[model samples]
Target: MLNMRTKAVWGLLALALSAGSVQAAEPEVTDARLSLLPGDSPGAGYFNITNTSDEPLTLVGAESAAFHMTEMHVSTTENDMARMESVEKVDVAPGESFAFAPKGYHLMFMHRAEPLEQGDEVDVLLHFENQPELPVTFTVVAPGSM
Candidate 1:
């Protein structure tokens, strides 16, 4: 009851989906998640990075087409005052966890790259000092999200 052309089309689609699933489970990328704020006017981005490999990892830097400049920042507090400072690298030990959040380690987007509507997405690539850059597609979310 099925035509040859139709079966071929279905096979192609299934192959494509399978390839994507394999890439998602690739070894290079371990645990990674990112979230952003709403009404983007100089808003920050949060990333939770987990190294599943046996070696250590150092976050070299980040870049985004959406922003004029992207930098890795670390927050500090002294005498009830808090400030952020740009850093060259962030480290993660084997099987360790690193967090980039408000009032802590985070990424600063100098300018809005794309529309900040919910469900919108941005392609951001993160480079590790010793590892190859990993490109991630992040979905835009409202402020104070997971």
Candidate 2:
């Protein structure tokens, strides 16, 4: 036996709480950077992605305004030789973090439209399998700095 006004108030409160929880469950990206070479060579990007929610997060692809193509790659050494391979997706477990570093998981930026110099910033968008597109800015750094 609840009044109409009381029911409306309760409904609004529930909606607000749900919205807050959704925001809190989103993943976080940090320490993003793009390595700049001296010439028109392909650059690499690194970052740390942290999943804060209970569910796993999957990154399917990435896009950048400075390059024609962005791809995920991983470096491995076999028989004393190092090689890189393209990766389709990367997964992060709940409450865990995925690191993109030198000689590890990284993003390959190819076919650059313009030259990138040190201290420049590039805007990149990360596509997720289940989450919304996350926008990130990567600072251009030297090749050896990781």
- True lDDT of residue 108, candidate 1: 72
Model 1 lDDT per residue over 22-109, tens place: 5222124432334555555765667678887777788878888976788888889999998889999988888778878667887776
- Residues 1-146, candidate 2: write the lDDT tens digits: 46988999999999999988765477899999999787878999999999998988999999998999999999999999999999999999999999999999999999998878999999999999988899999999999786
After superposing candidate 2 on the true structure, give the runs of residues whose Cα lies further than 4 Å from its correct spot: 1-24
Could you tell me every candidate's TM-score relative to the true structure? 0.70, 0.86
Candidate 2, 73: how far from true, in Å?
A: 0.2
Pairs with backbone N, CA or C atoms under 3 Å apart (clashes), candidate 1: 66-113
Model 1 spans with C-alpha error above 4 angstroms: 1-40
Error of 1 at 115 (Å): 2.7
Strongest candidate by lDDT: 2
Cα error, residue 146 of model 2, in Å, equals 2.3
